[model samples]
Target: MSAVPISEHVALVTGGARGLGAHIVRAIAAHGGRVVINYRRSADAAHALADEIGDSALVFGADVTDKDAVGVMIDAAAEHFGAPVTTVVNNALPDYSFNGDGRSHADNLTWTELDAQLRGIVGGALNTIQAALPGMRAAGGGRMINIGTNLVQNPVVPYHDYTAAKAALLALTRTLSHDLGPDGITVNMVSGGLLRTTDASAATPDAVFDAIAAATPLRSVTTPAEFADAVLFFLSPWSRAVTGQNLVVDGGLVKN
Candidate 1:
């Protein structure tokens, strides 16, 4: 089989406004990939990011969990770029804080909370995959990259709801990879440990960050930019033979 060069394709990043998602958008653009920045609420931030990234980025507002909305968004994205959206980064997330403060332990974890995460992780991903698959089929092939968490492996913090949802997403990612392989669509995930500082991790105390960094072999916490760049690898030709794989990027915290 031949390799698919990502730099020539249009990449759409859901929740590509701030934090890791935003970093992914910037990285793809920097490498000459056209980008579609999708956001559910961060409209202004999304637009500003597109402006900063110059013509390589375009902004769109759509709820990834909503299948119809996602289809419309995909249509608009393709129309705007004058080409099919051949790359998708399912990075949208529900409102969450990784501060370990006010986080529900198993005792207080509610089904409602898990549902929200599921909607964002699993449901959102399902919608995007369904909406974009046809375009990929028409365009010859494509790539799908899902954002995941290292907690699913380490479970350092018992963030029951969020962790559970990501675990489910991992399962879905593998299943989709199998089903989409024949169509030339590669499905995979990029899981990262506690990023140093995103809206979710902003409240995480310095002591926790320091402790994590000290424990990791790299002696430093992961950053959004670093993680984002790793996501780009899957979309690149280098990973044409890799699918149904979870590439964890937490500084070797969990050796595969």
Candidate 2:
């Protein structure tokens, strides 16, 4: 298989208005890919980011969990770029916080909470995948990189609902890898530990980050930029032969 350059792909990044999703957008643009930045409510941030990237970026608003909305967004992206989105980064996250002290334990975790997360994480991915299928098929090949969590593996904090949803995403990623392989679509995941700073992790105390960094081989908590790099790898031609795998980007914190 011939390797394709990042410049050859039009990419869509869900929740690309801020945080790690924003970083992923920047990374893809920096590497010469055109980006469709999808956001649900962070319109200002999304517009600001698209402005920063100039012509290489397009800002689209849609709730990833809404299949019809996602379909419309994908259609708009194709019309805007004059090409289908060949790379998708499933980075949209539902409202979540990483403050362990405030997290609900498994005993107190409600089914409603788990269901919400499943809809946001798994359902969102499913919507985007289905919406983008026709475009990907027409484009010949594509990349689908799902954002995951290291908590699914270690569960040190045991964020039961969040971990459970991401675990299911990983399962979905593998299943899609098999089903989509014939179509030349590679499905993979990039899981990160508590990133140093993101809206989701903003509530995390400094002490927790310090403690995590101290325990890591790199002596640092992963940054949004560092984690974004892994997403880039999965999107790049270098990963043409790679799929159905999860790359953990947590400063060697969780070696599995």
Best by lDDT: 2
Clashing pairs in 2: none
List the candidates' TM-scores in order.
Answer: 0.97, 0.97
Q: What is the model-wide C-alpha lDDT for candidate 1?
A: 0.89
Q: List the residue pairs that clash in candidate 1.
A: none
lDDT of each: 0.89, 0.92
Model 1, range 114-154, lDDT digits (tens) per residue? 99999888999999889888889998889999999999999
Best by TM-score: 2
Instruction: Give model 2 RMSD, 1 decimal.
Output: 1.1
Clashes of each: 0, 0
RMSD of 1: 1.2
